[model samples]
Target: MAETEKSGNAFVETIKTIVYALLIAGVFRTIFFQPFWIPSGSMKETLLIGDFLFVNKVAYGYSYASCPSLRLQRFGIDVDAKDICGFFDGDNTRLFGGEPERGDVVVFRHPVSGRDYIKRLVGLPGDRVQMKAGVLNLNGRPVEVEDAGTFEEVMEPQGPQRIRPRCANGAVGDGGMCIKERQIETLPNDVQHTILNIGPQRVDDTGVYTVPEGHYFFIGDNRDNSLDSRVPAAANGVGFVPYENLIGRADRIMFSSAGRSMLFFWTWRGDRFFKAVQ
Candidate 1:
């Protein structure tokens, strides 16, 4: 009888230890950093579809979305506390130092849909932004851009259907099809980043957009394919992202896989392992 009691106590102790460990891990993830997997080619070349990255939660300080109290509603736990944790100009935790700068690749919550979106900061507060024939123009001046080369990636099958190497950039003939033209872009802050100029998409030409106060403009490295600030939120684009919606900056690629899902370990991209997100 004593032996049975001892064994039961030991099992209870083991379960308690696991529960404590999980609670600690959850707290850490909610406060300092968060892991995100890229599921789309919106930020391709810079961030591939299968890339896994850690967002620096302390980079821009904490916000309402970063607070655990805000997430309680989902678990049937209600907290009447106001949403005022993460703010730059207002009172905030100020855990770290840094603000979003032009050319910085960041991850933020979509203003309308509340979905997480990643893109490069292109327009700062009060900056005039526009695009002319696929070339980016800021503050009445055209941004500098130079041709890099071509980029090609396989479009894997969806479910049981197979995909062919169709023209991705809307190019004619067999030569210009199935590949995207790369270009090196220099932002106003002198931050250089790569952009994919695939085809003459609708956003290739747009009217002047004067960024309002406390808002920033973002665009994708894949110019023609991304639905970013150039498009309105009502139209399914991110629209002008508010400062409070900012989450964190993407620092590096933790891991990468080319498979449709992570279960396909055979499709792991070994070369992109631990690659710095430039």
Candidate 2:
């Protein structure tokens, strides 16, 4: 009886410890930073698939989108951020809000689908944004863009989604080289980042988009592949995201793996560990 009691006591203590640890982690994620995993190639060379980073939630202050949305499909758990903090949404306000600067890489909730998307914030409230012949035009001025050779990667399934990359050099077989034209684009704020282009896309030339007040426009680094503000939300694209939907800024990549699973130690990219997001 005594041995059984000791074992039960140990089990109870272990459970208590786990509960406390989980609570602390939850609070940390909610208040300070949120872990974001790059699951797509939209950001391409800048933020590749399987890159893991912690978003600085305090950068833009707290909003409904700041709350973590836990969705474990296998476990049948689907807790949306709106479900946790829906009361704080729809006001277009944030507590201790700070304006996001143009050219900053941000993670925001989609205005219509409520899905999280990471992109470079290119248009602020009331800014006129347009893409003219594969170039970014801001307020009637074309942003400076310089050809920077090419970006190459193996043509194979990427991440867990098994999504293959589009190549400027046409379709290539598995393990073949996939190439995309690379360019260094300089924003009005003087922030420079590398952007990839596969070819001329439908969104390459678009009419001017006037960003609405309390909303922002964003675009992906992979110009041709991104379905960002260039397309309307009703058309399955991420339209102008509201200010309240701003989650945080991704400042650095904590870890990166080139394999399907992070547990595959052999696939880790050592150079990207703790790398700052440019």
Candidate 3:
């Protein structure tokens, strides 16, 4: 009887420890940082498909969007951020809010789909943004973009999604060399970053978009492959994201994996560990 009681006590202690650990982790994620996994090539060379980073929640202060949304299809658990902190939304305000500067890479909730998206903030409130002839135009001036050779990669299934990359060098067989024209784009704020172009697309030329108050404009580093503020939300694009939807800014990549699973230690990208996000 004594042995059984000891084993029961140990089990109870273990469960309590797990519960306390989970609560601490939850508070950390909600208040300070949020773990974000790069699941797409939209940001491309700047933020790859397998990059893992922690978003600094305190960067833009707190809002309803700061609350984590738990969605696990396999577990049948689907909880939206609004479900947890919906009352804090709708006013277009934040707690201890700070304005996000142009050219910062940020993660936010999609206004329509409620999915989290990471993109480079390009247009601020009251800014006129447009894409004319493959060049980004801000306030009627074309942003500087200089050719920087080509970005090359192997043509193969990437990450768990198995999504193949779109190449400027046309269709490529598996394991073949894939290429995209690379350019160094300088935002108005003087922040420079690499952008990949895959020839011309409809989004390359768009009418002027006047960013509304309390909203922001974002775009992907992979210009031709992204459906961002260049398209409207109704058309399956990001459109103008509201300020309250802003979650946090991604400062640096904690680690990166080039394989389908992070457990595949052999597929880790050593150089990208602790790499600063440009």
lDDT value, candidate 3, whole model:
0.95
- Sort by TM-score, best first: what order? 3, 2, 1
Tens digits of per-residue lDDT for model 1, 187-249: 878888888866788899999999988788999998877889999899888889877677788
Task: Flag regions of model 1 displaced more than 4 Å.
Answer: 68-97, 158-177
Model 2 lDDT tens row, 92-177: 99999999999889999999888889999999999999999999999999999999999999999999898899999997999999
Q: Is candidate 1 or candidate 2 better by TM-score?
A: 2
Worst 10 residues of 3 by lDDT: 223-232
Worst 10 residues of 2 by lDDT: 223-232
**Residue pairs of candidate 2 with colliding backbone atoms:** none
| Alpha-carbon lDDT, every model | 0.77, 0.94, 0.95
Question: What is the Cα-based TM-score of model 1?
Answer: 0.83
Better of 2 and 3 by lDDT: 3
